[model samples]
Target: MQISIIHEREVWDRFIDQSPGGTIFHKWDFLKTVEKHLGYKLLPYGFYVTDEILCAIPLFYKNIRGVKMLFSPPPQSGIPYLGFVLSRNCMNMKLSKKSQRMYEMGKVFSDEVDSLSPNYVSISLTPFITDVRPFKWNGFMIDPLYTFYFDLEQSLEDICNGFNTSKRTAVKKMDKYNMKLVESKDVKQFYNSSVDRYREQGLTFPIVSIAYLEELCQLYPCHIKVYSIMDADDNMVGGVLASEHRKVTMWIGSVKPSVKAPVNEFLFWEFIKKSKSEGYQELEMGGADVPRLCAFKSQFNPDMYVNYRIYKKDLIGSMAEWFYLNVHRKKKA
Candidate 1:
């Protein structure tokens, strides 16, 4: 087995879709797209078994003061929640007991980090496994992460029944609003409108940008879609921007606050129905922080899980560098 760095766009694109948790966003082109649109530097890591490619890691290198650190893509603008994405296949390959694969995979990644001259390495967004302690290195640590998942495999009857009676009643009341859900490829209009809504609520938009989303649309044409709820007046009231990679369809939703509307409920119901009709295995509503948002997501009866904020020595120093940039250097975020 060998590890290699890929700089070409096409090679990374082909490799990304083949990985177990592959998605277009993990492609090298996404890095270029983000660089062009949002100016973030993303490096790529490719693992190979003899001549066959096994897994890819989308990573970036950053220097904080005198210490060097490698991490997943950083938050664009003020948006938070950045994660290091790896193909689930990579995890499976790493954890396989048959060939002592997990140990080998860990060695390969850890060695690669050392070669890059980083003091420590970190991985985020990993599902909790019972035996990660066996995969540790001298300076590395694995921490459990929690994530919420809404099951789409169950019958709609089951999901609808699981909701609180009052929430279910609210969804039913949305029927009187005469809402229609439509799928669209127009990401710019949706992005702009959503940003405007966020600004009105004094919230920073958590999206990349129009150009970057356009690149993602081209990369995952069928998987990336905007589901919008239009009112009887032919205006979009509520909508969600979603990306389907592997079996997970994630939430990226916003609504017009001008009207006291049921758009959120209508949009979610439509999205759920669409997921069921399209045969998606699950719909990930994304993690929530606010109590109201958490409660709202809970209304859907998703399994509650927490995503960890793990840090290695070098990585935490990298964060300290960021703090210095803002505190001492006086850089605005």
Candidate 2:
């Protein structure tokens, strides 16, 4: 096995499309947009056997306070998980053989990353790629994260029935408001609402820019949809921006603080119904680290999946972490 820089767009995206673990975050255009908007230097790598690509990982290099760091799907891009994308050929292999192959690929990937000699390295793997033992064995730290997923294969009634009573009640109450959900091209409104929500809580604004969202929406029209939840007066009270890649549709959205009409419940229910109608097999609600957010998302009765945040640090990386924990991160907290 050998590692090489993957420069060909068609080659990179074809593998991503065929990989079961690939999400929209792994797409070539998405990475290119992130690079153009966020100024992160792309350093995508691939593992190969002779002439065929076996696995690939997308990475972005950035200098933070003069400390060079590497990230996969980087911060503030609204991408939840993106690490390694393996070829579908691996899926048909025996379990033991597949594990061995993955272990080998992991080692190669680790070696390739180590060669860059960055101060810090961090990446979050997709939920489908559960084997992080190889990375751990290669001297990387691993942190487990969680995300919620709804099986859209079930009937709409069955999916609705799976929601907890609180969510059902909320939906019923939301119905009383006679809210209307309209698919809109208003990315600015969505961005402003999200920023307001963060500010109201004394939190930092999201890392990705409104321009990035707009470009992404335009780049993948069929894959991305922005819906506005309007009141009787046609005022935008809540909104959701959903992105679909293959069989999965993910919710990336926000709601107005003054609007207490359970717009989120209504918006999500509408999103789910639309996804089912469009033949999507799953709906991923993204991750909720905060207790309140988790509680609200859990009411939908979605299955829980674990994602891994793998990291490695050198001396400068250690100092960076110390500064983050003691100074930078504390200010945000």
Model 1 over residues 1-333: C-alpha lDDT tens digits? 677777777877776665554544555655666656655356676777776666566666666556676665544421123333444455565335523654565678767777778643445543322334424643466665545666888888888888888768878788688878887777777787877887776565666567767776786677677766678987977677777666545546554446777677666677778777878877666555566567676776777556544346656575675675567433221
Model 1 residue 57 CA deviation (Å) reads: 1.1
Per-candidate RMSD, Å? 4.2, 1.9
Displacement of residue 256 (Cα, Å) in model 2 is 6.4
TM-score of each: 0.79, 0.94
In candidate 2, how many Å is residue 177 off? 0.5
Candidate No. with top TM-score: 2
How many residue pairs clash in all the candidates, one count each?
3, 0
- Sequence-dependent TM-score of model 2: 0.94
Off by over 4 Å in 1: 7-11, 63-69, 77-99, 118-122, 126-138, 141-143, 255-258, 288-292, 304-310, 313-333
Instruction: Output the worst ten-in-a-row residue range by lDDT, candidate 1.
Output: 77-86
| Per-residue lDDT over 78-193 for candidate 2, one digit per residue giving the tens place of the 0 to 100 score | 78878888889886678999889888987887888877888999898887788888989888899998988788888878878888998877866765798888988999988888
